[model samples]
Target: MAKLFGNLELVLIVGLVAALAIIGAFASSVVVDANSILRWLHLFFGVLWIGLLYYFNFVQVPTMPAIPAEQKGAVTGFIAPKALFYFRWAALLTVVTGLGIAQVNGYLHTAMSFTGEGAVNLIGTGMWIALVMAFNVWFIIWPNQKKALGIVETTPEQKAAAGPRAMIASRLNTLLSLPMLYCMVSANLG
Candidate 1:
């Protein structure tokens, strides 16, 4: 495996294989079905999005200034772009699939309502926050990052401005993520 694939590609391939195996198992099981598969996809994508968000906040941002200027280009110019591509898209899919689950499970309105106190309120709050973060990922950060990373052409000043905007929005999402995670987990609590 090491001879055939670099570390990153190998890791990605392994993850994909594991995901496929889980899906296969679900398909084979009488207890699981398509809806279960979709729910799993939602959860999987949500983890990917939030996981990347944590990576950016907990690891990447703090380390950037310390990275050598020459190497910063590799991180910012290459790795960051690839990671953000998956990050933003995963965010989008998470929202889509989560909503799909809510609709399928017939709890869309109930979950959104925050009707009862306690877990309902908490879960509703998290759902709303996640929705906002997803919106920011798609509508705000991704667009700004395009300019920041020169995915599209822009003046240096514009790129500089865009970078901070993206960072701020990313951080905002990171901050909301804690509450979002809490609500998501607590929502299912009996």
Candidate 2:
């Protein structure tokens, strides 16, 4: 049991197989289609991105100063870099899958251009918000994070400038995630 739970890849594989089996069994109620697959991928990676974002904002960042100076290496050296890798990739994939979903549903242009009525307009709002957040993740947050976490060598002054920039960008994403999620959910339904 411990061994099974210890490996994330193994756990995810087993979970995927199990879910496929169950969904297969209940195929009458659930239709597996391209749009659905895209939605699943979008949801999965969105969770990963947002989960890591929260972890950074709520857990790692706040606790960094509290960690013993000598012990800071454990986080800055090992944990944060790896977490950031997943965080950024997840953000990328989420955007990709979301765009795929929109394209498949034949609303990509209308939703993004905001030239349509009803749900397209609503979803456009969410899409734009997500695009902004993704931009922050890749462009602003990531570069600043590299300096702040010492992934990139910098002078003390530059590094000092980076930390708060990264944090504020991260917090901005956190604030946007709430309404972004709401817009995504409510767009089609409402």
Candidate 3:
């Protein structure tokens, strides 16, 4: 069991197999289809993206000042780069899977245009917000973070500028997450 759990890839594979088994056993009782699968993927990616966002905001950023000057390198050089890689990709995947779900459900246009019913409009609003957040993740946050973390070569002045830019963008995403989540959950309640 320890060996099985020790490898993340192995654990994920086993978990997927277990999920498949459970889904197979309950196939008759549940609606399993393209939209459902896309939604599951979207949820997974969304959780990863948002979880990391929250971790950065609530934990890492707040604790950074308290970290020793020498030890700051551990986070900036190693942990941050890794976390940002997952964060950016997860943000992209979450948007893609979400859009896929909207397309599969035949509401892509309606939702995107905010034209159909109340639920559609709500979801559309959420989609727009998420798109903005994803945009920030890719365009603003990641680029700035690369410089800030010293992944990209830059002067000390530029590096100092980059850190605050990334933080502001990340904080913007965090702020938007609240209303986006409300729209998503409320729209799906029916």
Candidate 4:
């Protein structure tokens, strides 16, 4: 059991297989809802992305100063880079799945127009905000982080400059996440 759990890929595969089996067993006929599936994916990836974002901002950043200088390598050298890979990909997946859900549900245009009443307007605003956040994750944060994390060849001064830039961008995304979530939930549900 310990070994099974230790292998992440194996664990995920088993979990997914079990979930599918359960679903198959309960239903008379299998029918998939595209929008619902995409929504689920969007929610899953969004949580991953935001959770990592929060981890970086709330936990890692604050605690870094407390970590002994030599011990910091455990994080900067290993953990952060791994986490950021997932973080950025999760951000991309979240946006793709979210937009796919919107498009499938016939709200893509209405929600993206940035001018509408009720759900359309609310969702549109959220969509736009999320898009911007995702943009930051890809275009701004990731590039800067490559330098900041020493994943790229850069001068010490340039790396120093990049770290703060990436941090600021990440913080901005964190700030935006709250209202974006509210709009996403409130738009259709509220």
Instruction: Identify the leading candidate in terms of TM-score.
Output: 3
Clashes of each: 0, 0, 0, 0
Task: Show model 2 residue runs off by greater than 4 Å.
Answer: none
> Model 1 segments beyond 4 Å from truth?
3-30, 115-121
Q: How does each model score on lDDT? A: 0.83, 0.92, 0.94, 0.89
Estimate, for each residue in 124-171, the C-alpha lDDT of model 2 and write its tens digit. Answer: 999999999999999999999999889998999999999899889999
User: What is the lDDT, from 0 to 100, of the residue 89 in candidate 2?
Assistant: 98
Model 3, which residues run further than 4 Å from truth? none
Q: How far is 53's C-alpha from truth in model 1 (Å)?
A: 0.6
Whole-model lDDT, model 1:
0.83
Q: Who is ahead in lDDT, 1 or 2? A: 2
Question: What's the ranking of the predictions by TM-score, best on top?
Answer: 3, 2, 4, 1
**Clashing residue pairs for model 4:** none
Question: Among these predicted structures, which one has the highest lDDT?
Answer: 3
Model 1 steric clash pairs: none
Every candidate's CA RMSD: 3.0, 1.5, 1.1, 1.9
Which digits, one per residue and each the tens of the lDDT, describe model 4 over residues 1-190? 9999999999989987987787678657755578757876888899999999999999998899999999998999999999999999999999999889888878788779866678888889899999999999999999998998889999999999998899899999999999999998898731
